[model samples]
Target chain A: MDGNGVSGAARHAAFAPLDDGGRAEVVARRLSEAIALGLLGDGEQLPSEAELAAQLNVATVTLREALSALRSDGLVQTRRGRGGGSFARSPADASLERLRRTLRELTVHELREIGDQHRAIAGTAALLAAERAASEDLRTLDTLVDQLAGAGEPGDRRRADGRFHIELAAAGQSSRLTRQEIALQAEIGELLWMPSGEAVPHPDAVAEHREILAAVRLGDGQRARVATERHIGRGIDQLIDFHLRLARA
Target chain B: MVSDVRAEEMSAAAREVGTALDEVFAWLAELAGRFAAMHASSVAEQNQLRAADLSQLRASIFPRLTGNPRLLAGTGVIVADDVLADQPHWLEWWQHAQGGTELEFLEVDHDPASVGFYDYESAAWFVVPRDTGDRVVVGPYVDYSGTDEYMLTLAHPVSHDARFLGVAAADIRADAFEALLLRAIGAVGQPAVLANEAGRVIASNTPSKIAGSLVHEAEFAGSPVRVVLNQDAEVRDCAGLPWRIAALRG
Candidate 1:
């Protein structure tokens, strides 16, 4: 599965190496993001080392180093013997204590800064997606939105939610923007939509996704941008509230 | 209600698995302590331990300890070392185990080349106790390197005086656990699952709902023990791990 959850075409484009020295780090980051987004499921067997290294376009040694780094991070496992190969380990739940610690470590200003960057990137992607998205792209976006709406678990919903945004970026027909969206989602995606004591209900986010999709489908660039901004803004507000609550507790 | 009976059966089955796991953990803790002592003495004596020491350890230990015949699929230990530069000894064990009985002991090198260009330090069984300083239960994951069967790992940290040695570990085949679970709750007519903290089903009575699929706790709201739930699922702690017994009633 290679754990990225995207179709083969999109994955190829997104993972194409941009530079050399940091290739393994980039590959590792991309895979880690995919794993965190639940695109790569727990216990899923990864592709063979040669195949995966070829897919990521790196030397076998580089891929090995990246895999080593991932192992240290507890995101992957290697077993030996007949059928033994590397497998994805289930990520540890972002413990409330860890969440609280993260919040304590960040100031409100920094959170707002991250939110602002997210809004700019997401807003721009939505605007472009509305302008350039084809009928098929729109259909894909709709399907992802539907998946989000029907998703019952927080983890499933979160992954679908992340995919919807990345798909929107892809619909914009900009591989660069899609890559940026992937990186952005990797950074704040899990924390922004982290499960809490029913603080930020998923239905509201799913409803916002529908609005964004509807505008994008109609090629309403302005409306798409507005919808995207509002959705991201609401998420930012909820995260701030969560941060404050955790800090106080 | 029939749901009550089903819940009881499910709990009983979960408890059985939990008890088996508890015994496994106790054995691991004792083994880990012995290894820790040996490792400390080796370090003190400046002994240039060869790969043979590890092979001897595995031979002495894995062949001697017998686990629950029905519940356990295999038992083995992995020590953290750089003894094998190019090929992992665990892969050798896996090859040997494949030729022998259904269950076999296995080990892996932390080095990537020996482990199919993969590293073991990233695994939960190795990382959790190293990070949390506690014994940990990991998986219902496919042991692609061992039996290629879905298995759960019980691991304890082998450390001495704050110096971490390696992990002492064992593998429990999921099919065995699933068989036991199905025997307990298969006739209940409701989907029952035992899932880890991540909501991945470890064992389930529903054929379609196989192990490793993500299941939410909300799916089990109708479960009798609802409020004591951890995360999103109705759960009762098993073996001090985050594993839980959850059921979805029709």
Candidate 2:
């Protein structure tokens, strides 16, 4: 189908206009976060200034100010000459301050709702994967579990964790599910792992992955679904705790 | 028997669809050949295809492509590594967004480490033709990183002087392409499905099994209803592509 409802909604959300009273800081933050989350894509040329400004529903001058801010933050680069345009550059670090502000603004209800959506997508994916995954899919899941275990850095760990879930959806053999999983990871993964400065990812993450894999390998669909939901449930609890702590600060 | 006539007519309809795809492939192959020829004759240092030189050809590509009934999302050639000295990875593609008036060049993440990197070489449309030296059509799947639309990609390999160069590929909107097939098979007046070798529905006249729905493998072999190019049958293939049409009992 050309523009299935969900896909069309995703596209619309991508270029949706800013809320009233949004400024250059708001624009820069949104673009940088998207770039950091890998939505904008590294080395991808952005739309022309006027087109982008119109799409974002911002004045061209405001957009230019935002673009300069992104440039200084190393999230974007502008080149001059023929075939030259602003390009995305995936920054290595996300702004914890911005993420903290975002989390603090959201109510506990919103946080739980996001977790519910995550569990719905992931739990169904794992259940179907248990029933339908090929032997090679099992192998790939096993390998991702190993990668998560071996990952030393928090960024590496976050990436490995996100990949495992995405691959889990892919193993279910539903492209629509796989895509939803990807978008969700970009939206929520970093936030879940945001408190990475002094903390290594919980070792239990790898163990939870193993448990999910074991269930999937044994074709226990219910067990797989429950395990995935449990994993996400724990993650959301921790995020809520972090949000509360931020509010107090 | 009535069953035999039904089977023959369905087969003919399948052939008609296959032949239409074949014509598209032939046109693509010729364009690839011309691009290869142009690259070979260039006097530039190392004979690399320069952007300035290729700009001339890009201007001509969109007009010729506009003639096709299929609403092409994009079409162009991907140059193999080292073929273009100026850029390491390049796809000289032009895309017209649905309902757009003019075609615009597509720019994608070429960096290997980027999450949105478009590795065309690994994609089926490019890989199948490069490996088999034959035309290949892939998808009815989403092109998430690039177009963000569901698409079917048809590609033909481009080779020069016995060395593989790259591929000339076209991305057609799956919805439009499916519409084309639905119109072509309208005369069958039965619930017919066009499916890939994996039993994944490419398109169907029925709403029950939409694109990406899986048809049971057993249906291909065990169904009494007529199937063109049934599993392991020596029946004429769908123009050398691994697809079949089945007219199920309504």
Candidate 3:
């Protein structure tokens, strides 16, 4: 991918140099996101401390502090001796309780802000896709919607939903949009589909995907954008509602 | 008559690229040959090669193969499903995890039921060579499933005693590979686009034909300035690779 393209651009942003203050926490947060998102696969060896520090543009001491914190959190484990390095340790399931706690920590304003960013990216992707998408791209979108419809578990639903958005962005033929979509999906996709007291409204989600797909197939850019925004808008509302309900509990 | 000369030049340039890519495949074939030999010898000794043995083999060759870090992000061997005694599916792959100095084993879920499962068997890179018994270049597209990088996967089938065993594969970063392609196409000094069989542009000297954009053959059907090279010719070195160079008469 071209460096100016979205995927490359996103990668550049993902590993870009950071500022000094609270550096350890920032590094820890970013690495946490990458692991949870499978950007760093389970049991994958992390770069050496010095190499990682160089890549993240932080001091070796700060990188060590972040790695230690992740180790204590059970997200990373270090082996002693040769072939010994910090490895990502993703559990079989992303803990629902942990997700709930993270959600509870976020303010309504923060949730809304993230939603706005998603809408911007997804909406534009839909609009472009209506004009640019080929038959094969539409077929992929159709399959993802069906996958969402048939998904019986929260994990399956999350996977289907996240892939739909990413595929939609790819259909837009903007690697940049695809990369941003992946980042946003990694950040909030799991949360939106979190299996709580009430299961995520998959039938509604499937219907929304259908609407967006229809608009794209018909080359209705305006309708596609509107449907996409509505879909994301509803998800944001549901997340906010989930946060508030957890607060009450 | 002038168009004939341009067509000849375009074909020559395409062949040059074909030769370079074939050399990469030849290198992978050598690796595959080693893997096949190891598998065969282990079988002859009545002891199947274990995952550890494969991993050790990969680790041994990884450093030497990665001397040109810009051309390849990683390389490894993936055996046929259920071929390994230790696991149903196995990939003994290692990569420079971040284009950095450190090499690490690639971690992927092989479970069919898991959401994160990497179904390499279904992937073109594995399937094409495995079935055809030939080398193949699979992409200049995003690898969302594995490395999450846009890369070209070059692979060759490994076989022993007429039985297919696996594929020796390498991932080439798209940017670096594209630069190589552009250099080849640029040497022809013509406005040209190199596309895969799907008509997806791999690289183009002309801005109108951007990389990753699909080309409609009909759009240039009647244009006298357009010369679709490789329409009927299969460059010998790239016999199994389906790519073409479409050059415009500039």
Candidate 4:
């Protein structure tokens, strides 16, 4: 309403100033970009409603509604007053179902890329986890492995197995590495969670976790690395197989 | 880190954080409104403190001592609950003092359990000569004598060209301050308090019926802050810590 518009911090950092595409579009674009670029950073705060509303030339109600969508998507978190602001987190939507939904949206090529990237990173992690995983951390992995091996239900086994690998990632003993492994694990689990896409992960995902732990426990870094890679590679092969079948059909 | 999956994962994290911050903002605004109401009420009380001249108030309303010039030397006439509890006969003295010209004022000094009253004459009718020997009776009808022991004092020093003259002080009792704080805490009650300059319990509306130990002090996570700084009464974020509502002691 005032001179071409107010290009405040929220405008430049958060909203679209020139196009004046209205508030929702501006906020959506900003939020999407912020997520994509990791600009918000995990645990960093987003601007306040009044700040966003003023920048977008929108009302407080509009800003709040936009935030609600982000909340539903598991992208942002809201707290009440004084220092109320949104926080950013990597893979904030860590739920098994969300991982499935996100993986379902991926192309076969993207799945291959994800698999390759994870193999490279996790190969390094398995090597480190063997050398670096503390006694307590290793015990946590061993206990979960025992649970994974002993679990009754298919769903329970799958969850425990996932937890065992997650423990392995934590055992790697670096926050950055652990965080990255967690994302990769989410990707791997998602590829399997959507049963229609990948059939390989469904067959022996539980057993694969055991092999990796067994190798790591014996202080055999090389075997641990290979077993971890083999398990993940098997999941990738299934995803590729399904993709090919889909094309043929 | 700059990869596609990394990008997508980071995006979700940002969104989660953003949502939580919004909720916190809503909570802070409500607190500001409550302090504003307290500010208005305190301001009105302070004006009454300003109406009377320094000398007149010193002799009549200042916390005087009982007897013996070697001591405070004046049977303290304040709103002490001990004395007000047995009024009517005692208050009948006011109804009949100096052919009956009781200066009007709030009953806090008179009654800790009472709300407030406007007794201007009760204050004006009782001024003694100052060191200057000036006896022109001035008028500050409000009294901050004995109300609830817990009190909020906002002291604005009456100044002269950047010089200190006297002070304009507003005293809100613990009960009145509690009403203001309750409005701020709202339905989802967060423990809240208004501490005085000395960190003494000025007020609290918390529902925890402190059966024994809670006699006067408020319950807090740590020792209360007692320092007075020059700042506006406002709600502020404590860096992901507690959302604090700090009202300046004025």
Candidate 5:
């Protein structure tokens, strides 16, 4: 929950000025990414348009345009008159039919490739994080792992899972790596970890995260890399099973 | 004292916009996941499937989804296949309309071997994701195929196992996006401009600073809202890509 340090690292790499044209799109895109990453909570009230525009160094007109785009996309809703400001809407669930369609598209091979890339980035990040992480960073990672373990819903668990990896990346102190981790999560994190019929068994994942954390705390890079890679490898297997079932269905 | 009040209002607007964007991306990610999933299945099931098969899948899947209603021109999907020749997917939604809506969904294909002018693979939307294997939102460029209008494409890569399938994407007309910008600024009560990362103005209340013009940094100095710009700028990242929102008062 206290992710100020991690979020700052993420924002450092995530936000950059637009060169020309598409200002609104850029504004809209950034906010959307933040929302997807769970950096912004559902139904969170936003700052005043004037204040936000100035903060972003964009024209108020441009900020508003971006907001309007979001509104059209059903991401934000506006109320009129007093207390009439835009608020974030909870994300819509992808229809089951759509999920089926999506499942049909993904293959076991691709899942493994995604898992492989995840292992490289996450393994390296964990190894580096172990070497560089402060006690505070370790504490945050522990808390996130705990959060994931306790999360009752798939969505909460998924977000916590994502934040744990991102925080690990931040601990490594590489904006590039942190950004890469964030992008990978944004791209395939949810789908790869999505829970089918019952909740995804979290005990193993929680234990794996703890093992990586323990190694990082002990400053054992080799142990951290091995643990992180194994953790991801296990996830990849679970996802493959999920996809296989979908294909067979 | 007046500047303080103005600053507060500007801050509130920025927060609102930020929150709104969060919602948009959340929705998009879900759609991308579904598309990627479906595309993956298609690739896995039929590795040797023709371009026509992909086209048929696109035609069936894209038209059914209820895209943004504010879209001036309707939305559709595109699948660029290197192996298959340029076989375009005609927009069935646009064709069967009752009213004389001045809209046309032209069929454009990206054929690597084509001698003609257009190359879809070269487009940023297609190339970026293909190279990175990440979802991409590209545009505000002239879409030669459908309506010859500036458009935004929300595209994701489709891969089966390790084999890359094709790009699954949706196009939203740029004018629709511009309209949204125009309305947002009109309500904010300030002379403002939205510029891309390259400093080209995308939208502006200042009529002189039209779209496509380089946004001079000095432009923020003379406006009533300049005090707002004096404060630290807020940076919003879009679609997990490098694109961002740097709002400046002018």
Candidate 6:
């Protein structure tokens, strides 16, 4: 119909280009991304609405509208008067809470597929290093080698692998650099997609772990870092493939 | 001022006895006020026992004890004149704290006549208004470790509007009174004993020595004729002869 009721027209559809809600979402996401990257540290105040609007090159009203949405998301909070502005709530227990929360996301079938993915990645890494390690490298992984070789049961070897990886993180030297690596290893253990008997960490993984340690001992930061990346990356790739399989299923 | 100078020139023994008696009675009133305020006020709330009340009571009445260190210190023994509680809790509590202060609370159920016995933490027994009170003798009675301890233990009748309440007895410091007597009578370090209505030795300057004997032998050879502490009653005849019968005035 050519005729429109008074104050009832959908003006954006007729002429004014963008959806307001969409524009607000863009502002909200940018702020959230800034918070996630720690571009906004805890206790650091966000700009005033006028200042933010000027920086973002937006109308003050538009900025206010966007900030209102951000406030509702729990990503930022406000205080009053001269000293007050928005700040990030960066909890130190984020990783623990994330793992605790995301656990229910797994299904039984998805779990098994995740287990299969883990085996492929870890098994390949273990295989690759057996032929590549030097003698000293073998010696450096000796403890892990002995542990895997002597493990009384599959469950026992899985624990040995956990210890071996923790030691691997220790070899990294930087405490900050090693924390995520250790947490990821622990999270993998929690997922428990690893096979009970045959899915145990391969026998050669101990030697490879030793080889990586040896490489580091010889002042080979590059090799040590690479080996570790490969080690953790294997677990990560398994996680991705597991998710993919889960989606297909 | 000339009479005042003459008053100061009076016999040391007489002055000592006067000062001692004045201090003892003043202390009695102080103890009474404290009992009424602290001991009795506990029955209700309100620690109406402020310094002003005690200070005024000291200034207005017991002027002899106005500058007294003990009165200022707010320390001394207080025993209720009449027994109310079966077990006197305050005295028992002071015993528990191992505090040296003595407290006595009176109780009824007398053996016969107007006699009362004092029980000490030392397990010694002293009958107040000493020998005259109708009680059997127990010991070299309550041995107090306290110094210069002259005490006046007395029992006198109290009337509430012509109605007689039980006879009231008090254990008061006799050392001050005895010292005043010493000054009054010109006796230096001579012993004196004060027994109340029933003749219990409340305080003695040299009780351990003099209480046993009356210096010169008695004509009767029986027990000494007990000095009775009746209010407003005086015996001038017994003065200067190692014996005294003075009226009890509050």
* Residue A86, candidate 2: alpha-carbon lDDT: 91
Candidate 6 residue spans exceeding 4 A from truth: A1-249, B1-19, B38-88, B92-118, B121-180, B187-212, B216-250
Assess every candidate by TM-score.
0.43, 0.68, 0.71, 0.30, 0.38, 0.23
Q: Model 4: residues >4 Å from true position, as ranges? A: A1-105, A152-155, A194-198, A201-203, B1-250
Using lDDT, give the best candidate's number.
Answer: 3
Give the per-residue lDDT of model 6 (tens digit) for A81-104.
777886554324344234322433
In order, candidate lDDTs are: 0.64, 0.71, 0.74, 0.43, 0.57, 0.38
TM-scores for chain B, in order?
0.73, 0.85, 0.85, 0.29, 0.64, 0.34
- How do the residues B59-93 of candidate 2 rate in per-residue lDDT, one tens digit apiece? 55777567663567788888777677677778888
Which model is ahead, 2 or 6, in terms of DockQ?
2
- Candidate 1 overall lDDT versus native: 0.64
Interface RMSD of each: 15.8, 4.0, 2.8, 26.8, 17.5, 46.5
Give one digit per residue, the lDDT tens place, for model 3 in B1-250: 7567766667766777666565666667678878988988888998987787786576445764568677788888988976778887888887886746888889989888986788988787888877777667776656777776777788878888878788888888877777877876775565777776666667778887777666666644223222222333332232234677777533
Docking class of 3: incorrect
User: After aligning candidate 4 to the native by TM-score, how far in Å is the CA of A94 from where it should be?
Assistant: 18
TM-score of 5: 0.38
Q: How would you encode candidate 4's per-residue C-alpha lDDT over A74-96 as one tens digit per residue? A: 66788778877776443433353
lDDT of 6 at A186: 55
For model 2, the superposed segments whose C-alpha errors exceed 4 Å read A1-98, A121-150, A163-180, A195-228, B43-47, B68-70, B184-190, B221-240, B248-250
Which numbered prediction scores highest in DockQ against the true structure?
A: 3
Which tens-of-lDDT digit does each residue in B1-250 have in candidate 4?
3234333433333333233323222322332233233334445566322222212333323322111112111121222111122231111110112222332343223332332332321332221111121112111111222221222222221222332222222332324434434443332133434333222222333544210111223335433322222123323211212222222211
lDDT string for model 6 (B1-250, tens) is: 5433333333333334344433444444444444344434433563423322323333322333234533221233323223234433112111101232332222323232321233332221122212222211121111122211222342322232332222222333333333434333332223334433223333344434232122223222122333222224322121112233221211
- State model 6's lDDT: 0.38
Q: Is candidate 1 or candidate 6 better by TM-score?
A: 1
List the RMSD of every prediction in angstroms.
23.1, 16.5, 17.7, 30.5, 28.3, 36.5
Chain B in candidate 6 has what TM-score? Answer: 0.34
